[model samples]
Target chain A: MPRTSRAVKLAALPDGLPGPEHFSVVDVPVPVPADGEVLVRNRYFQVFPSLRTLIGGGVKGTPFPPLRPGDTLFGAAVGEVVAAPGVAGLRPGDLVRHWLGWREHAVMPAGQCAPLDGTLPDPAAHLGQAGVAYTALARDARVRPGDTVFVSGGGGGVGSLAGQIARLLGADRVVGSTGSPDKAARLVSELGYDAAVVRGGRPIAEQLAEAAPGGIDVLVDNVGGEQLQAAITAARPGARFVLVGTLAGQLAPDRSGTTAPVEIDTFQLIAKRIEMRGFGGLDDAGPRPEWTERVGAWLRSGDLTFPHVRVAGIEHAPRALQELIGGRHLGAVIVEL
Target chain B: MPRTSRAVKLAALPDGLPGPEHFSVVDVPVPVPADGEVLVRNRYFQVFPSLRTLIGGGVKGTPFPPLRPGDTLFGAAVGEVVAAPGVAGLRPGDLVRHWLGWREHAVMPAGQCAPLDGTLPDPAAHLGQAGVAYTALARDARVRPGDTVFVSGGGGGVGSLAGQIARLLGADRVVGSTGSPDKAARLVSELGYDAAVVRGGRPIAEQLAEAAPGGIDVLVDNVGGEQLQAAITAARPGARFVLVGTLAGQLAPDRSGTTAPVEIDTFQLIAKRIEMRGFGGLDDAGPRPEWTERVGAWLRSGDLTFPHVRVAGIEHAPRALQELIGGRHLGAVIVEL
Candidate 1:
């Protein structure tokens, strides 16, 4: 007998804030595995800010297709395989994490699903948040020990993991900027950040000066515009300013009131010889079999830890997304069916 | 009998535009060279825009001491050595070039002066404009063959030589921006620029699009502000934007009738992987003895030609500066005494 599954589908495009009306739950037949494919019954789904951007008409200059009405909201998920289609190594009843959608059941190519090592405390750790964030922070930032790393929006899913990863990588000092004082405290006490500052209340430069005192060496900026400018001003000579988001605003405001476009003094760069870079998540890059092996080892060895996940049902994914958009949540918001 | 020399000395700090009142010419007894010092009779002095910025108190956070009232006005210059203080390989009546000052005579350490080979058409070529500009263009910009190079302020001293050096480096296409159509015509016809666009008239992106068609790979910018923004917009992925000057105004005006601080989009950097670097002439870190040797070789071999220079007497130094400040001259303005 074929199994039935509940899935979250994009009901409509969101304007400013995503609501329950923007998503709808529907029942669908579990997909059957085709050649070189595996059948997975998803247990956990990942919700993130990029999803918000995606639902709002997608990122500019993106070459991929955009999410449309009635389409199942796509994301990476953790599931258990009931059957495999002509694939070796992967067997029935294996817990796996794969890139699929919000559906309770998914049929993906065998290459997409990686067998979750039983050694991990929770298989969902590999699927939703910890996996992508850790891989991105490690590979893209090239985090190292004795380096001073600053994470903007530190309370968010990626920022929280990035801070932890920085600490695990031997960062001598880890500073974070969050939207609230509670988030700031959590970032410090719970996430191993050396210091945390509340954003928007005070001048970021002044706050950073109090936090780091000796200028930041590596700034992982997810909040752009004014925050980015403050970070730039607070950066030490030869610092690296990495842009990961522009949540604050697209353009930096002119404080001097000259009505002129911001003219970055190239001399700052000349004097300090700083390098600025940007990075997106690693989902686009094909599965790094070694990443799984290594992160799995780290997870098993207790060298890395996963953040507390807020789980919701598939029907409540829209509420979870709304919470993420409102910046009310501190960790990964995962939806389960 | 004591020898007499004329020197221009800084009088007082001016509020904005420096004038003849800010400088005083006085006669002094030329002193004999001490051990490790060489006495040179000055020939040519270079008037640069950086001097203007310095005089206007525009640069901030610089390590060097600011100009003091009644201090000698020093800059890059060329002269003939009349006395060598116990120095080997240098003799009286030998023409040399050193960053001395705007004076009729100067006594610098023997280690500072480099003996100029007489093969050049004019010894003033080393002192006037060729050295700093060519060294900056060759070593800093790293101009290579087949690169599409864009030069701003092509009618000025550094821009002219930068264009010539780009050509000498075998750049496949070279475009320049000038303040006037006459300069643009001169840049295209006489200076061998592939195309020249009038500055402040047309949008730089549109002009660059029409000129290069493909996109600019290397930008040697002398005029900053809006042109810098436009250059960033027109840059090809992985292109280099080199900031060498800020003549087009330092602050960019914004929409709210206020001046916006200059800030680059770190996202654009990630998407395009572009590198924006600043080249501040041959300072301490740049190729020094090797650069002098190589440029000297090029000059001696007649492979690099020097631009025409307008000469003024020592008393006319203030007027020459005025002319430069007013943008009245082309090529280099050299004060020969």
Candidate 2:
């Protein structure tokens, strides 16, 4: 008898805030694994802001494919293999992480799955601090000793990890910025941030100037609007600004009270002798096992900590994703399947 | 007996476009060379757009001191040594290049100057193509084999040499954008640009898309504003945009008939994974003798070419600087004192 599986499917493309109406939970037959394939029973999956770009219309000028209506939402998931067909290393009980997710069961090529080493306290840790965020900060930004590091949107998924990773990488001072005063306090008190700039209370540039004083050596930007503008203004000569997200989006209210495109003064990049590069960790098919091992070590040694908000069951995945896009939740937002 | 030398002095910091009133010709007695110092009879000195920044209140932040009134405006000049005071590597009648110009003669420590190897036909070449432009393109930008390069302001000083350097670095196809149609034609006809985009004729983004349909892999940005915005739009995944200038200034007329701050979409930088870095070349005090040697070898082999607009005599220096700021001249602008 064939097993049955349930999955969350995209009902329609999103236009800003994605509601429950844009997703549907549907039942389907579990896929039969071919030779060199594994069947995974997912335990947890992630929902982050980058999903907003994918579900809306996809990233322009890149090959990021948009999901059509009725297509299963694919994402990183930690799961246990239920069936393995002619797979040498993977067994039915083997724990693994794969990109075929947002579903109860995923049948994919064995090579696409990475078998977890069972060192993590929970498999879901693969989706949080021990994954993309760590690699993005440690490798791409290369935060070093004596460097003044700043992470914008410090309460968010990547920002939280980035702040901690900068500390582990030996940053002299790690500063973060968040939209809420509570998150701002959390960054300094709980997270590794030496200081946090709270948005909406003051112009970000003034806050950052007060915080850094000397100037920012490295800025890992997650919020792009005024914060990014502020980062540019506060950047020191030969500073490095990593472009991570546009949480502030592209448009802003102009002086006439209408939305106009927000701009970056390119002159600053030249005048200040800054280097700004965009980073998309693990998306480009680079080496990840080394990064994964290092982060795992950090976690095991208790040097790294992560907080995640969870929504139980696959049906709540859409709501969880909405909460993430709305910036209503701090830290990583994951769904238990 | 002391020799009398006439030099151009900054009369006052200019409010905007510098006029003849902002400069004055002053006579001074040339100082005798001290031990380890060399006196040079100047041949040519460069007057490019960056001077406008120094004379106009200096660069914001980072300790760029403003030129005080009556101070002789100093810059790079190539000349023959007239007096050497027991300098190990220096002697009278030896050609050398030093950062002491805007006058008929300069006296400085021999260590502050580099003796020219007498490879080029004329010493003025050291102030133009054989100097900062070569280093900025080859070392800073690292133009590589088969790269599709786009140069903004390709008719002007650095842009002209940058395009040629890209070609010599094994770029498959090079595209350039300039203000005038004549310059656009010249980029393709006289310079090594494979194609050209004429600004103001069409939206720069549209023109760039049509010119490099495959997308630009490397962008040497000299004119910032709309050109930088367009380069960001036209960039391929993992493209590198070298921030060389901000000739577009700050505010530009938007489509809504209002002056808007020039902006770049940080989201696009993330999506495209583009790396944008500012280039300062020889200004930062680094070892350049190796670079000068390689570039000199290239120039000697007839692989490199440069054009310059000369303003004769010290009195004409201010007008030449004005012409460069006005974008009236092509290639390097030099003062023949």
Candidate 3:
């Protein structure tokens, strides 16, 4: 067994869209599993935009551990447990996903590590399709059957999965918005969107009108800005908006101390009777083991697709995250450690 | 019975906030009841901010009928049914409330008018505390026991009642925001609010933080601009914001072609997991007859108070409405015809 494990750590607090200079990977002694713990060799780690909060600053009151210099990055990662001394129901070679990422190893409590289903061919696929998108569509937005759905940032991690989830929840039509025409076309052709519109080409309100002429019944807003206003304008009466991200500011060249203003018209809000809700990640989405299994079965059957940009090694993880933030990548960005 | 009834008519569509010059009272022959209809002698009519929507312009797709010049203005009013013809369960001298208001007489189907209990001394009180505030609190916001509630524009009709209603619903604390210092003091002293903060003097966010140091669990936002931002900042995780009005723009000297921007921060929305819902009045609130009766009982018992500006005569109705639009009147504005 290798005595050393390489882990990614914050080099410095970020000033803007993060770069490789903000992170460092160092060799360290692999953590030894104490009582009731298992040593995990992390195979793959996920990256997304919201990690900036943990990396750059801290929320006043949140359960998420704030990232600091020399501290290993934290996120969802899939790994194989190499050692589980005296821990029942857990054994060596068992593939598990846990809340520790951007590292070669993790020593987690045995019961805390959820066993990953080996149904899908690629183990990394287990890391990308977490519960947030499904929870937003089914629980938060309540994307009912025969509903017309619109998703902003439809090519991003949550948006990509949310469109398919909306369909699986019985949405009649799924329309998406993307930043580039190429991504717009890809959203429809590859991501199961019935139609897609480019964000910048025309006013989103104008373009959304043509895409969903009857107006959207459910909106999964991953990019908030003018897009949020356009969604409010195009929303059918009693439409539900599940806001998951603000990638508009995430794409900025420098967003040091500035905040993204999500403007909505009060008249339209009242007239449309819109319901807007925001949700955090898996923790906020209560444990839905049956629902998760159903989703897993669909994935295994090729009914649902998990789209992601895969990087070859841990060294490329920070750059991949930077590129993902800059809108250079599509869908979930993950590194195979 | 008088053969002719004097009614307030819109002389012109509002150029700005509206004035007496834009309205005229005309005498017209009272129509005789036909079929199952009754001729109502409207004793009092209520005028508030949202009535401007029906009076000034049109909402493309809504049940609310548009107002035009030479037409009697429409709103909630309480009146004694003079003649019910052959209609059963309704009789003359029975006080009832209906949607047709700002008039001295109304011809309506007997079944359409809801009976007003004589328990509360002022029948005009029923015209003001309609089902919107009740519905917004109970169903939309789901304000629960021991929750901290915050209300913006707490001096206005819905806002005034919402603060008291929050307490009755078992809220641990109820805080309110108003435009003036006097209204702020009156919110706690007269309106059953636990605490009140004036909007303009100190930053609302700062005052709100002091008022609700633990943060607010529910927000009934009647004023939308800066107050909305303050409420969002002071919101607790899983807070629900029930949006009932946009009176911030209603106080504007001239809002001819402008729209009120409701600004929200996406990060706070996600981190806090806030749910925001907007509702129209009365019809959208659905019929809550039993709850209305309960609220009426509360008023009669001195537990809930209905505060309103009472205009003595129909001739002053237009001026009263103008004052309401200008934010000069507190609670409801009702005119005794």
Candidate 4:
């Protein structure tokens, strides 16, 4: 058993996108599992979009509290149980998915650490698809069969996997909007999206009109500024827009209500009978078993692609998160602990 | 009956809010009713908010086509059937409601005119309520009993009656937002609104926080600019916001997308899970009979108050509409011919 472990603690709250200076990776004595708990050696942790909101404080509507200085950051992690006491169904060498990430090891109640049967070869793959993506598109937005789905920030963590999940959920056509031209190209070419609209090139409404001529039925929106407004304009009557994130606020130069305000023409809003909702799946405690089983089958059979950029070592998790925020990486950024 | 009647036609599409110069009243010979048709002497017509959009051009998502330069305006009008031929329920002097207003007389298909039983005193009362407000709050938002409701454009037509309707529909408390302080005070005192927030006096979000303190459960929004944004900010999680109008857009100085845009902080949107849908009740063909019966009962029993501003003649309707658009009057604006 390892005698010591490491954890990434919130060194400081950042004014903008966080970097290594904002996080302090420190050595600590490893915690052992108590009664009904299991000691997990975390194999891989995800550097997702919510991390940007997490380090700044916390997102509203989510149950997770903000990390104070010296507090270990929390997120999704796939790990192997090294020790268990009085825990049923969980044993040593069993792969599990749980919160308490940003740490080399986590001591969690067996109930919180959901076991992953050997359906997929990579433990990191378990961190990618099961819960957040499923909840946003299938459960929340209810992406109907033959529905046209539009996802903003298609290169980011949840958004990257969301397009694929939407398609698997029976979306007839998927169009993604990305700030990066390369990411836009890759989204259409590799991620099974029918088309991709690059932001900053032209008016998104003009582009989306050409991309999805029938108008988008469902929108899994990650960036929520001009993109959201454009999506609203291009949405068909009775369309469902699932607001997954607000990168526009994060990427804003000013917080004075002057930057990138999504000006929705209310006349259009009522006329179309559009429905929009916010998602807080990342803060959820458990993954849906049905999603894991379904997604795993798809991944293993080569029907789905989970393009991930995996970084080595827990010490680099903070940097991985920064890269994810900067839109440097396309798809999920997995940090191997 | 007069051998000739006066009808108002669109003179020219106004660049902004239309005035007397934008309309021309022309004399036309009254036509006899054909088979299965009724000749109605128009008693009253509504000079409501939709008239603003109608005069500018038809609203999107509604079936109502735009009025050309010479086309006579169409709207909700309550009239007395002077002649009926080969029609069931045949009677002269029977009060009925139908489209084809802005004229002294109309020859409508017998099926088009819905008869209104003498549930209330005035024939014009039928024109005031029974459709738009009921559909917006009760049907669209589904304002539950014990729910706190917030309404924008409280002094305007639909908004003025909507508060009373929401309260009658079992809303625990009703709060309204208006630009005029006098209107706000009247909304609380004369109308059924529990509290009234004056826009342009304080930040709407701060006022709403004080008004509904518990957070708004339902929002029947008419003016969709800063007030809508404020309502979104102050909304309780899982609140339902019904989009009723875009008076802000109507009142904006420029149509270049630079004015009065509702900057929705989408982070707050998802966190609150606020659900909003558009209301197209005004453009609908018929008044719901159930609403008329229920509202008539409410009005007669003194359980509901239908506040209205009346103009004497149809010739002055164009001016009444201008006054209504300029916020010179409160509640429903009715033009008696």
Candidate 5:
């Protein structure tokens, strides 16, 4: 029997900021499990800023197809397996997390679904935000104990979790920057961050310098542009600047009109031997199986944690995305059915 | 018998461009060499732009000594061994190069003297300009075969030799930028440069783009300021921007009472994986012994070549330095006595 479910679809492409009008709710017949597939009823969907880039047409140089009008919004999700076709081990009613989508139910390849153990304090923890955030913080940045780390956009889902994970990794000082003072205080008080700065008012360099007087060793930047520029200035010699977002704006324009000016004191790099790297969560999945294990272990051990999400029903996903785009949410925003 | 020699002494420190008034000729008795020491009759002295920094008092970061009223002007020079005290393998009258001074005679440790082999075409070749220029080209930039290389200030001693050496390294295309059209033509026709552009009037990026349509793979930057900015704009993905000099100026002051704005798009580095390195020939010498051997082999094999220098007498070194500081000379300027 074919199952039916409600899914969020892109109604129109956003210009700069995505609004509720850009997305529409639609009822669709649920997919059936094929010979090597499992049918899952999705309980949680991950909403992220990168998804904004998808809704705003698409990002250049990305390997995936762009979202056109009336296309289903897709991402990683946690669900319960209701049926399996020739798939052993994962029986009916088994909880799993897979790269499912905004729909209520999905038929994914059995290989895609990983059984979510009951060890996690919450089932929603392993599916989206916590999973990717923990993996990026551990592997890519290679956060070590006694290292001073700066997480930009630190009040957001990934940044919030990354702060705690850095603390768990034995970071001596964890500094975070956000647009809201409330978020800043929450990060410092509740999320184990040593310091947090509210962005947009003062020069970030002065604030960062005051926050980490010894200097910042690792920068997990989720906000590029002016913040990145400030980070380069405040960075200790040999500091590793990681580029994970361009929330400020992508193309930095200069006097040359067409060409963007990207300047660093070349002497600083030579003196410090700094290394800068960029990575994305979607690309983190295939090549690195260790990421899944690490995140799973961290969740099981309670070394890393995230705030409870404000779940909206499937029809209210557009409203949730709007809240995210408006920077009205404190933590991860997920849609549930 | 002790040899009496006339050496150029620093008379005064200059506020900007150094003149003959800043230097004074002084008569001093040359000291006798002890064990492991050799006395050399200074023949040739090098006059480079770096001397300007040494004369303008001193720079904070670099190791150049501040000029005192009566201190001897120190620089690289080629001379002939006049006496050897308890030193083996070198005889009186053997030509050698040492970091002596603007003096007629200098007695120093034997280790400072590197014997010049006659197997190389010119004796002056191992002196100041040729040796340092060739070393900078081969080691610092790591010029490779079939690479499109661009050099700024190409008519100058280091830039001229760097262009030819890049060709010898099997560079598919060697382009250069100079201050004058005559120098540009000379670089293309006389030297081994594939193309040369007259600087000063237009942006370097436009000129470089026209000269090397494929884009620059390695940039041997001698001129900074706007040239550095333009090169960064014109640089291809994965290009290596090597900062070798900053003749234009360092630290351009913004007059707006605002912060000095330097935009660095992390995306530029991420998209191209570009590597920016800064090198001083002085720093390159200690770590890499292979640099000396490579340049020596190239010199002996006739694969790399540089122009004969316009020799000034030892007494005329101060004038030659003034000329160099005023940007009058094309190729390397050396003082011979």
Candidate 6:
């Protein structure tokens, strides 16, 4: 058995767009499981846009504790349990999902790990495409049949899956917005989006109005700021908006305070009776197991496909995350250990 | 019975604050009820802040049609059915609530009228205090017992009632915001608010933070713009925000688009997982009858009291509406026709 492991650690709290310098990949002794704990050998981990919020100055009074210097960067990962100590649900070689990523080996409490149903050929796909997107759509947005759904950052991993999930949920029309026209075209052609709107160069509202002339019934928003504002404008009366990410500002290189803060005109929320909700990983925690079962069934039935960007080697995780945050990656960025 | 009836008509759309000059009082032949219709002699009409939205150049594709030149400004009214033509549920003397106000007499379809339970001595109170506010708090906000509730524009018609209703619904603490210190004191002393934050001079967020430092579980927002922004800042994780009015912008004298649009940092929405929804009269249409019944029961039991400003004579309605929009009058503004 390997007696050493490698993990990414936060070297410093980032003030703005984080760079590779803020993270350090270092070798450490392999963790051993204690009583009622499991030692998992990570197969794959996710590098998502939300990592920006975690590394950027922490949200004031955030419910989840902010990552500090010297702490291992944590995220959802799929792995095989190499060792288990008096744990009822797990045995060595069992596949599980746990929040102990950016690492090769992790020692976690057995109860915190979820056993995968083995329906997906590559179970690591659950870390991104099938996880947050599924829970947010099913529990938060509650996408209904015949809903005219719009997704922001639709070319990204979760957004791409969100389009498919909306279709599965019986959405009549699914429109996705991406940063470039090429990606927009790809989203519609390959990702099952009914239509795609290019996000930049003009006010998102004007572009969205032109695309969704009638109005959006449900908005799965990954890019906040102006994109969200545009979705609000394009929303029909009684539309539902779910906040999934704030990638619009995640890629900005200039972290200067002088930049005018991106603003959203909330008047539309009142005038049109729009319902908006923000969701995070913790919010999806309770419903995740149910969503996982459903997603597994869909995967087994060939009803779903996940688009992802895989990077070989655990040493490349910092760069992979940077690529995601920099908007260089179009789909979920996965690190293969 | 008089053969003629007088009504207030919109003279022209105002660019800014509307005055009596924008309305014209004229006499017209009393409308005769046809089959399945009733001729109502309006006893009392409401002049609410939302009227500004109706007359202010229309809210784009507003469901409530913009009041045009020579068009009767419609609103909720409590009146006596003077004549009913084959209406099964109505009698000539029965009091009813309907959206046919700003007039001395209105001919309305029988199906549109909502019969008041006749529990209160002055059923005209049904138009303002006991109408939309109760319905919105119960249905839209979904105020649960032990919730920490906050009401913006708490001294106004809907805000005042929202405070009491939150308390009646078993809220642990009810905090309210008012534009003036006197009204702030009144809200805490006269109304059932646990505390009152005066909104002016300093940023409202500062005052609200000081008032409800722990954070609000539910926000019943009446004044939009900065008040809504401030509430969003002060909301707790998973807080429920119900948008009831945009009187904050309505009260602003400058109607120029140059004025910085009221901005809400929606990043906070995602960070805290806030749930926000806009509430309008139409939003309450489904639950109103049941809410009215519940309110009538509360009123009969002396468990509820409605504070309102009653202006005598139909001639005073236009000015009364201006007062409500201009933030001069406290509580619900009603005109006795």
Error of 4 at B2 (Å): 4.8
Q: Which lDDT tens digits does candidate 3 get at residues B1-337?
A: 8889888899998877778999998998998999799889999888867667666574444334667887778888999899888898788999889988888889998777877755456787677464667778888888899999998888888888888888988899999998788878888899888889886588888999999999999988887888888888888888998888777776666674223566777777877889988874554223446456667778778888787878898889989988887778678888887
Q: How are the candidates ranked when ordered by DockQ, highest leading? A: 3, 2, 6, 4, 1, 5
Candidates' lDDT values, in order? 0.69, 0.77, 0.80, 0.79, 0.68, 0.79
lDDT of 6 at B159: 86
Q: Once model 2 is optimally superposed onto the true structure by TM-score, how far is the C-alpha of residue A202 displaced, in angstroms?
A: 0.5
DockQ class, candidate 4: acceptable
Q: After aligning candidate 1 to the native by TM-score, how far in Å is the CA of A25 from where it should be?
A: 5.6
Winner on TM-score between 3 and 6 is 6
What docking grade applies to model 6?
Answer: medium
- Provide TM-scores for the models: 0.74, 0.89, 0.90, 0.84, 0.65, 0.93
Summing lDDT over every window of 10 consecutive residues in candidate 4 chain A, give the lowest-scoring window: A252-261
The list of candidate 5 runs beyond 4 A from truth reads: A1-176, A180-182, A186-198, A214-244, A250-263, A267-301, A304-337, B1-147, B152-171, B225-236, B250-263, B280-288, B307-337
Candidate 1, superposed: residue stretches over 4 Å from native: A1-147, A161-172, A250-263, A280-303, A306-315, A331-337, B1-45, B59-100, B103-147, B154-158, B161-172, B250-264, B280-310, B314-322, B329-337
Candidate number with greatest TM-score: 6
Chain A TM-score, candidate 4?
A: 0.89
The TM-score obtained for chain B by all candidates, in the order given, is: 0.85, 0.89, 0.89, 0.90, 0.84, 0.92
Comparing 1 and 6 on lDDT, the stronger one: 6
Candidate 4 on B161-220: residue-level lDDT in tens? Answer: 899999989999899988788888889888878999987778888899899898888999
Q: What digit string (tens of lDDT, one per residue) describes model 6 on residues A1-337? A: 8899999999987777777888999999999899999999999888876676666655555465556789888888999999998999788999888889999999988888888776566787768566677777777878888888998989897898899888998889999888887888888888899888886677778888877889899988888777777777688888888887777766666651111135544455677888888875533355346767777777778788778888999888888887887667677888888
DockQ values per model: 0.23, 0.51, 0.52, 0.41, 0.18, 0.50
Ranked by lDDT, the better of candidates 2 and 5 is 2
Alpha-carbon deviation at B3 in model 6, angstroms: 2.8
When summed lDDT is taken over every stretch of 10 residues in candidate 2 chain A, the lowest stretch is: A251-260
